[model samples]
Target chain A: MSTDSVTVHGYSTSGNCHKVRLVLEQVGRPYQWIEVDSPNGATRTAAYLAKNPNGKVPMLERADGAVLTESNAIICWLAEGTPMMPTDAWQRAQALSWLFFEQYSHEPYVAVARFVRGWTPIDSPRRADLPRLIERGEQALAVMERHLGRHKWFTGPGYGVADVALFAYTHCAADGGFDLGKFPAVEGWLARVGRTPHFVPMPLPHDDVRTLLAQH
Target chain B: MSTDSVTVHGYSTSGNCHKVRLVLEQVGRPYQWIEVDSPNGATRTAAYLAKNPNGKVPMLERADGAVLTESNAIICWLAEGTPMMPTDAWQRAQALSWLFFEQYSHEPYVAVARFVRGWTPIDSPRRADLPRLIERGEQALAVMERHLGRHKWFTGPGYGVADVALFAYTHCAADGGFDLGKFPAVEGWLARVGRTPHFVPMPLPHDDVRTLLAQH
Candidate 1:
């Protein structure tokens, strides 16, 4: 690991965790990855909560003991001064737009859907919201499809944090029971992001995500 | 208007409105500002809604006629390729972390509180939510105070989109009936953002936001 490196606390299969790791790999930064279990209440521990009051990962711990949480924020900080950010103001905003889209329009649906389908059992109470969640998730994907049709990337011409933000779960959306074939543009965009140099594949969670779901 | 520049839709007083304007001024870009009224349903018209299906302002219309909405996203697009984005991967993440913080933690409290207090009439039914809103708003401010206690800027020394994201409502937080004096660090940070060369103030909406809220 590089001396000035940082450590990321996250579960292997988490989309948010994947977002940070992708940046680390792309930037060629030397950082250690420490797996933290979310299902087992790993984030609720006092030590983890101290790092992030919100009790979410992936959290970045700098050498100075300062810890940062929120996957997109960590990527923005890491990609600053790099080519990851657009050169133009409008382009930059576009990048942020997609990120916001991911959080508000996308994550609430896609991320939560994954939790329901992959983290919870079929008969679990959380599964009650699955249908609506999946429908909303498809709407989010529809938004992505419209945008990806024009731009080669989320912000245009290059793979930036926006791509990273959307790429996290989009590739694995099928596992959430999303029929990825319906969103051809999003599928094409996923292929493009996967082709980026130094791109890292999201690791399969220790418990096969499907297996975890079956238990739920 | 600067030749070949961009155009922004929405009134200045809007928190999202300020985000786009802040970056334009910060980056020295020449862009035309077009005022659109959301409260008055100006954004609901065929022409405006055609540009953004979401019917929100703070829309950035590019020279090529592509329109992008969502204030934080717009600002990030602007800040890209500038020093506003951190150089290191970790630093970039920090910036996004704060941006997310602004959206999830700060905006819901500060911005929503403002809507409840400043935009709504004192005796309006919305007032019932104001006390709880203010209570939660203070909690958000406390989080910011704790973070700002150590760092000069939300992401670090150099200001980034995260600052813009948080700054939009923070400066106008008082109008929302928030006690600005409660958080000195946020106050200082606001002053610093205000001092940035060429920084522009958000113009209050033409139709009183209060009247708009009463209608709701």
Candidate 2:
């Protein structure tokens, strides 16, 4: 860790949490990670809730104890004044627009579908939502596909925070039973994102999650 | 409208859309408003989809024909360089965190509950989700209550974009069956937001929707 390193409290396998790590690594910022087993009531602990009343990960805490929550917001802050965030006002607006879309339209469906499919039991009633989640998730992917067809990045002219934000869940979309093959543009974009400098893949889920994923 | 004015295509009654109008009004930025009847398929038209693949409002269009989407993103951009957006990097990050929270944690439930109750038929199957929506919406309210107990605003030291973003849905929470009386701090903040310069209330839903809300 560097003298100015920040700390990230996150669940390793969660895409929202992985987003912070990927950006920090890519930006070459030193950081420490404290894994929070969010699914097992870890984030609900009094200590955790005191730090983040919203009770979720990944959270970025500075040495001074000022903290930032919300994955997109954290990355945006980490990427500011770097090439990871656009400097042009209009381009920055475009990047922020995609960030909002990911949270509002993409993640809730794509990420939630993956969690419901892998984290929940086979007979879990939430699994019944797969079809609707897939449908909505597809709408989001198609929108991305349309954009990737004409542009290389969500942040103008480069791989930046918006790409990082979307790629977190998108690369693992298959876990949610989504067929990325249907959207060739998105697949190509994902590959392009994978090739960006200092990029790191999200860690594999633990044995329990993997077994559940395999069983289903 | 001024020579540099932009246009907002939005459904008048939607809180997300209303956020754009509110910030633009408060900033005194000249803008043209084109009412989009989102729930009735106005946004689904091919012409609209060509401009915004996400097919949602409010969509902000520049005079040069460029466009920006996502309601929170729109307000952030509009408020940039104004007192409504913090100039300090950390304060900006905090404002953004709340903006993401409003979309992900609050609007999906609070705003949707209002929609299900008022826009859908009384016998519509979506009403079945209301109990769950209300539950989740209350959790979001509790988080805000906790935050407001210590801070005067979501944005540091002032009412800004985050406050506008949250007030969009929270002020109308009663329409979603949310009881503001339970969250006194949040109620106070809402009243403070109402007194901001040029603050405008979201347009009342039409008679058809009002009748459904009254029936419910």
Candidate 3:
């Protein structure tokens, strides 16, 4: 545990990958970012697969070569003992509740729906799946809107890993072709998370984010 | 925090609901079980919806009227400060990582696939979506198979909440048409979690699990 170095293997353009980098920045932890080319099949390589058989991005390599995957898990590990994780048992469970919601209720619709809309052009062969994705995506947003209507953050009064996990892909959901204007509460909550110090935009190509951020 | 009375609102047939009961029984926590009939849309009532807007089952009602929903989240909360939660940060995060995987990569496929196959007839309208569900379901199982191939448990060396989260639906996934025999590692794990004290078999209507246990 004496080693001060941390290396993250993921693409900068990935929302899940950005979750780790953003937390590291927030915690003021020093680490190196090794951009894994996910598009080019870098994760599927034998060496990388040995580290994580799932072959997904956002793999964290500790100084001990003890590899960890799953974006929220890595972030929570880094945020432990800090103000990021609430000390109370129930509040921690509340945080985990949101993290679970992010994966179950939110990501399946918001993230996958985004992929359907943004990654594939309207004329692509996959366009047929768009309507169902949009329907479910809207349902996910409605759930978030209802919750954020009363609370400032997902877990408690303060920002925690829940905010970070949900914030990653949600801020960019419109790019996936779902209208953000329909969810006013989610929009407001997104703005609140953005105002936090050390808040980093989801990883995208520099020029694209530069343009997107300019519009904001 | 001194209140000891705990009540769970759920149905016996639901794996999600069963998970909360399983944990409560395992921890030796005294609690009352209140049934919610999803088949009759009982959870959608205004009374139940206030408890959880998602209208899902397995909601925990603390003695103070504070309600907690989501099976995984509730289990973690109930298990907190107990032997189930790992004291170390990394091991805890690993527990959460698997929980996230269960929700994201595992549950969506296995549980939903089960809902489609088990709840609906073979010629049901939902069967149209079966191929996509089966494809993703098999993929998720493959990921778990690979992970279990290396580690004994999902997180710590001992069984923890991660196992509880995955164990509930996975053991019953055969009802959803998944061939459990193909995944030998997961089969071995099923045997392992089954050996734990207070292990309860899946409940059926008036099935008398205790009587069945005595017979076994």
What's each prediction's clash count? 31, 0, 0
Cα displacement (Å) at residue B74, model 1: 3.4
Off by over 4 Å in 3: A1-3, A206-216, B1-3, B205-216
Compose the digit string of candidate 1's lDDT tens values, residues A1-216: 244699999887889899999989998898999989888899989987777876778888988897888887777767766788676665676687778778776887788888878776666898878798889889888777877777788855788889999999888887777889999988988988889899889877556666865453
Best by DockQ: 2
Better of 2 and 3 by lDDT: 2
Ranking by lDDT: 2, 3, 1
CAPRI classification of candidate 1: acceptable
* TM-scores, all models, native as reference: 0.76, 0.98, 0.90
Candidate 1 residues B7-112, lDDT tens each? Answer: 9997777797888888888888889999886766898798986787656778989888988888777776666667776666656666777788777767777787
Clashing pairs in 3: none
Give fnat, all candidates.
Answer: 0.73, 0.84, 0.82
Candidate 2, residues A57-115: lDDT per residue as tens digits?
99999999989999999999999988999988778989999999999999999999999
In TM-score terms, which candidate is top? 2
lDDT string, candidate 3, A39-129, tens digits: 5689999988888877788999888888888898898888887777788888887887878777777777777755555454445677576
Candidate achieving higher DockQ, 1 or 3: 3
Question: What does candidate 3's lDDT look like per residue over B75-170, in tens digits?
Answer: 888777677778787788788878877877777778877677655554579868767777777777887888887899875888878889888889
